[model samples]
Target: MNHAHSWVHAFQDRLDLAPFGSAGLALFALALKFGYDDVASIGIDAVVDGPDDRSVDLVYVDRDQRLAVVAQSYVANTPKGQAKASKAATLRQALSYLIEVDLESLPERLWPAASDLRSALAEGAIDQLYVWFVHNCPSSRNVSNEIRTVGATVTSMIRAHFENSNIDIFADDISSEVLEQLYTDTNTPILVNDKISFITHTTLSFEEKEWQCVIAPIKLSDLKSLYTSHETRLFSANVRDFLGMKAGDSNINHQMQKTISENPQNFFIYNNGITLLTHGVDVFDVPNGKRIDAHGLSIVNGAQTTGTVGTSEIEPPADAFVLARFISTKSGDLIGDVVRYNNRQNAVTASDFRSTDSIQKQLVDQMKRIPNAEYDGGRRGGVSAAIKRRPNLLPSYSVGQALAAVHGDPTVAYNEKSAIWSKDALYSRYFNEQLTARHVVFCYGLLKAVENEKNELRKREHNHEKLTKADIAKLEFYRKRGAVLLLCAAIGECLETIADRVIANRFSLTFGEKDSPEDAAAYWQPTVKAISGLHAHLEKAFSDGLKNQEKVRETLKNFSQIVATLRAPFAEFFKSVENKLS
Candidate 1:
């Protein structure tokens, strides 16, 4: 149609691409003819929270910039209909497409090229490797915590993968002398955790590990709108003008032309500036006069200082005309569709398709139609055979070996690419530590309870343990003094001990029977050691901890059960306050 052709012409200039003047132009002519109107002005068909809905078929994954788009439609659409409609692409899918698709030749197909559009990708300045991860949360306290855990997991995976290679494979593969120099330059790693989020870094020295963590309550809606709107508003001017109005009033109408001219992407929300606006919507109300809606005409910004007082309304036409114009002038709809399709394809593709079929069965089906010669080539290990083996080289195939593969030649200068920790190891380390810390704190409390009951048994005057009533009474007095001293030690260890007399007084008050100073000095070492050991174990695990989750959980569960079992007798023993007054 002539209408669709206009769009094709408009975008060719906008994208700095040639008008469909190519050898393959005829092959795609039918697609362009049918989809020209709808693809020219794309929009999300539905908003999905997850993957289960039948409507969702495509997703858009924006790069490091914090923007993403996805869409879904009912299953009835045809194969050609599917091609014309754009879908959302997941990060993994986007990466693959980016590598496979040639941007130069297919400008109309991949319009809104990553660079042509304005996005947080440029704003955030995320030049380093970009990571997107999916995960499961054991307890659903905070859904966003899932995002934080994924990030940490990816970081650890990278570090471990690199560390092993630096020590093993890369060292032998590259010049040894260069490897040592590179190792010396890196710092001991640090990991910090706030309740909600954490970051980790490392240095060469092992002395101290540091972590930076943050915890905040964030609304998911705020994040989605913040980034999504910015990305959408990047390419349209008519939408921009509609958004600049401070209040829907007469004055805005007078200056409407100026607003649209100033901010073109109003058609889509970009720059966090014009977030909510759409074409073919009402712009001004005449009440008794004439009511003007969005579709009738487009608004442009004003340059002149002097302006008309009344809504200097310019009449365009009807809603359909405006809709037609929007589709004519902008490619937002098409780009959004592409993003949606990408996501749908990604979700379906990434799913475990091999679940029902064996690899041999799949190979047989794939080879059935191929000529015997082609099958023979594959059997003999030709190009197709090499492709099959590539997955084996990926780190996920065997996480343990992946640990050794990430380090680039330690002998050479650091290569920024694959030489970082693998994703699996990093996730394993942090998840294990948090679980272990909770277990240790619980056990430490139980140990002290057990100690208290044993001390109680030592001085009880009952003949079951020692002497008669009178002798027992005397022993009781000493037991009371000793109990007080122990309590002081617990407090000093549990809390802090200042330079005041309280620390020494707590111990002195409990000395029921006079004893040599040497006796008190002898007890100090063991008590300090116990407290020190508890702190060290917890801290070290918090640093590197256990990388394998199953092993760590099993260990923690055993420790917690042991401590809980000891609680009964220990509670009874401490149930007696010293009978000093009696």
Candidate 2:
């Protein structure tokens, strides 16, 4: 369908509106999303004549309290619509149904109970006016001019019809910057040009007598309701309640977690290009089952908060090894509790968790016996058995080292590494797995979150000094998906960053399993392709944000390029390593 068709689709869904009224509503909705507000339509004979045959799509009510009808010209075909499946048709079709109203009587008609409502609501001044047009199968060359002319015609009618309103009219979707550029670039005398550009130009006469027109006057609120309802029904229901659910709906998050947990094997795995150095971790969950990890870590969706826990609150599962040893535990889900604990740790301690050495010696000894404990390679690399005996000593040692480093205590500074590596290996393992998955989901969610963030940032910059909790909540939302894409993209970028000479050196580092260059490069191929697929998926999802989106979009545009840029080099790198191994 054309733009006119899709726009009308939004309006036609409302069973209560008259056909002309529905068209008017659609135009108003388009005007709202596109930044036009307070619209009024003008024309008595046209209203009586019926909007079924009118060429205009929407009408605008100026801040000055004048009414102007508008007509829009939008193209339909593969590239703009079918090629990418955009909303151009719906927007165009909706724009074609312009409504006409009387400026002198518009205040009374629009707000029947009060004529001052328009001015009172607008707070006395208006900024822009709009006119929409409807045309059928007009040639490409004539569409632009036709739109301008139709808008002009409605402007003239509105001016002659009202006589003294200071209202100015403009075409739909023309931003102030774009309009300024258009006017400045046009060939006309400075004085006349300034006065007769997009803001000032009005049609003295209509040239396209062949096209049909429909015009109606409708309330902006009704339009907003209709369009949003239409969009919710057609595209995304979540967008319908964006403001209400931005911090996120607990129900939605639960549902998402349920879906993921219910289908773990089927869920696509996304790694952060990092993994446990050793394997074999086992854990049991009643009513569910047992899980095994070759890399000593299993990734599961992290627990979601029920929101009952405060930032200061901390709780531990009775059977758990670490938190269980501390204070009395609380009942309820552990996810929110864990998040709170982490948050508090970061806030008060500036670290997420206590060092393993902080645990009592008896408890530390018991924890060490538990098989498949998560390990930190950086800290546990080569600790002596004697040092391992002192469980609570590590935290003090680590903290002391940090202080001593600043205070010039050589012994404290020398042993800082042990403090960092004192946590349970199994715990770190689970965290890595969960975080890898969360990060990927977060990246994907970021594309959708961009506009919301933009609005939030604007509000913060103008109205609030600090960002709201809701805005920060978006951080968790992004972490849930964004990390996956970031990891995959990181791998791709890494491969590209290494020059030809360093490529051989990189392949050695890339392979954890083999020293053979050939085998290493061959193993890298599938990994590269997997990362590339991730890039492709994200690029498509974020196509609207051209700059950030374009990075991956261009990278994945060609299948051959993906293979050449990412696949072949890895293959050669592996082959070279394999020869060395042989």
Candidate 3:
């Protein structure tokens, strides 16, 4: 199947959104642009559309990424040359209501998200603001022109309302073609198919195995042009995309921009330079420097440097040069390895560094014994580790999160993941000698069960299935940010009732050796249903924050008391599946 057909086929299973094709397009685009897990972190609040929703269909805010996405969506009932311009005009109205209106004037339903966007901007925390009109139809001159106006209009609004902010704004029509390209990008690396030839100072070539390498000094101006021409499409081989640079003295990307603006002459020596993966390269002598034409090129590393240079408001010095390392390979496995081992741009890479820990090794061995299980243990690497999905393939960071949320400190799992991997205190707290594959599966499965329940609720809404008032109430509570993680924490506190024993260390609890996370999730479904009915007790905890430890502890305590009275419902299920270590 092609991209659009594939989206139709899998949207229901993976995204839990295929019924309301038009309304769901914004989220579909958001998921395609960013990962779906990140969207879950933001919650169902991100998809706000109904009466008083105004023109905006989606509002996504990630302070950690220093980014926010506000989108309007449409899927034409009759396939047209393009979507109506009126829908595009709605983006302008959405921007005004979100930025210019007073907090009190907006509807109660839209207030929380509108406040989040404005607050993130005011604190100067957000650097990238993406305004998209996502649709299934093709792009047109009129809609494209309207999108351009939307960008210009939002820029003026920010200048007037947030004068201190230097927000980088991008406006685009996320049509089917764009979505198809984004889908294709996940697998196909070389999107910038333009033949690239540039002046080089002293070129060097070498060969090892099935790969060849070419090293040279490439002009920063030339790189800037390459980036200007292709934009983000230049880095399509990288599945993560750019995390968007922040503006501050402490920010590394900002520091890179500072270096280029202040001392361009030393950019070559100061920066780590760019690494290019290519199909072939041709070298020829030029007047002063050698010229090389590189074909099928994508940057495996140093995207930040190229992006810094490309986004510079100032022209780089004429003599400025950065070293470029080009690798040409015929072997596909080597190509994947090249992208895996070399590419490095993430907010959390410390977890991958913990791949060698003894606990992680033991877990890996233990996971192998469990059928249909693959646990990376913080050593998650490359495309295969990223895009592939299965019944119980648990990524390392998620395992860290589940363990943290179930044990204690739900906030650390939800908000402070970097600390979970980096700080020795947090690292040792979750992945210690007591940690095992079975424990990881038990905790991680509980978190997955909560997420699955939330998705099922969303699927019900999308399918227009009639829901009970209690189910509606539960859905509303689950829609809040960090609710799923907090509930995971809450449910962990009530495990004594399910286990029918006084559990000392929750980390020591285990499911059967043959059980995958899926099996554990199945065993815990009764518990999830039991907790799902008690939304009223859990709703009070979010008065503070979903990830707040104090609120989480209070909520967990209250729920434990309430669930102790309801123990009979879940005891039988846990009793049959509980695999206490021998």
**Cα misplacement distance, residue 181 of candidate 2 (Å):** 21
Reference-based lDDT, residue 66, model 1: 26
lDDT of 1 at 387: 16
Question: RMSD, model 1, all Cα superposed?
Answer: 32.0
TM-score of each: 0.16, 0.19, 0.82
* Candidate 3 lDDT, 427-482, residue by residue in tens: 99988998888888889788878877876776787677899998888877776666
- Report the lDDT tens digits of candidate 2 across residue range 1-582: 334333334323433223233243433343323312111111110111112322333333322222333333332232132211122233333332222343343221222111221332234233235443332222233344544554566455545544543444554433222223222222111111111101111112112332211111112222223233332221110101111111233444333334333432222231111111111222223333222222211111111211111010223122211000001112222222222243231211212244333332323343243332222211221111111222112232222222222121222122122332334552332223222211211121221123223333333533536755654433222222122233233343344332223344221222222122222334344343334333333334233212244454344334324445654546554343233321
Model 1 scores a TM of: 0.16
True lDDT of residue 282, candidate 1: 28
Local distance difference test scores for all models: 0.23, 0.27, 0.75
TM-score of 2: 0.19
**Evaluation by TM-score, superior candidate among 2 and 3:** 3
lDDT of 3 at 259: 79
